[model samples]
Target: MTALTTREQIVTTADRLFYENGYEHTSFADIAAAVNISRGNFYYHFKAKDEILTAVIAARLAHTKTMIEGWEREAPNPEARIRRFMHMMIANRAAIKRYGCPVGTLVTEMAKLDHVAREDANKLFGLFRAWLGTQFRALGCGADADRLAMHLLARSQGVATLANAFGDDRFIRREVALMEEWLTAAVAHATPRPDNRRRQH
Candidate 1:
């Protein structure tokens, strides 16, 4: 594999550090050291912490778009595609229990800091919302697609936050199962049933 460039390395390292430790808690020196580069070299690449943050967010956006595309290719069925997103919690439960979710934590930290990149961080959520909305639309949700997408995003974040707080694997598993059932119900309700004009109540 081709090695990541210096700037890419710095941004990648900062992304991990910022997720592991809140943005404000992690310092320039920390990221520099983590990347095994001097502060001067780090500054040469990322002049300010926020600059690094912007790069990291951009990288995340690109990576997420690519992932969503892969999901599209891998699961042509919208419901199955949506399940892949939902099942991430169960698949990454260990990390969720430890870190609360890389996206959620970063977004929350940015909000609390009133950081300039808060909206940029939010666009991460926006990506999921829009993609899931498309998937819902494919499932024939029509006008309710975006709302259903947001609902799923909200539900997953809530589960991630509480799962982190409680570190309960069982709760994570149960919530995932419930979310799956919820998706099935939503799809069922969204679809138009065949006419039952002749059937008795």
Candidate 2:
């Protein structure tokens, strides 16, 4: 195995700590200890704990984006894409049920703690939401595409929270199934009619 670079060490340690311990609970010292580095060396890579957390958040978002791309590629239509999104969310049911959505979890817990961190977290979420909205639009999901995008995110977070609270994967799977049903109905209803009118029959 290639020896880890300093930047890699810092980020890998931060990611592990952020996941194992809550984002709020993990400290720079914890990260340093994890990597067997001095606090000063940690500071060389990250000026503050918030900086490390921001890096961790960015890495996590990138992983999630890759997952979304995989779903988007395989899903043939808006409705199917929506169902695939539900399945993706449920794929992490057990882990999300245990620790919650990583981005959602960190943002909810730490966004308000610092200005820079909050802005970084907000941008991450904006990118995620926009990606979904754009996919819905590309698939010709109708006028309510933006709303559906938001609803999908909101419902996924709710399902994760419920799963975490109950310490059970059942609720996570159930909510994802419910969201799939809701998406199918919504997308079918929203598909433009032959007359090109917004009114439903």
Top candidate when judged by lDDT against the true structure: 1
- Candidate 1 lDDT, 142-184, residue by residue in tens: 8999999999999999999999999999999999899999999
How many backbone clashes are present in model 2? Answer: 0
Q: Score residue 186 of candidate 2 by CA lDDT.
A: 65
lDDT of 2: 0.71
Top-TM-score structure, candidate number: 1
* Sliding window of 10 residues with minimal summed lDDT for model 2: 192-201
Pairs clashing in candidate 2? none
Alpha-carbon RMSD of each model: 6.9, 5.9
TM-score of 1: 0.91
lDDT string for model 2 (8-118, tens) is 778877886776587778887777888887777667778877677777777777876777676656665545656776786677776787787776777776655664677
TM-score of 2: 0.81
Model 1: how far residue 198 lies from native, Å = 39
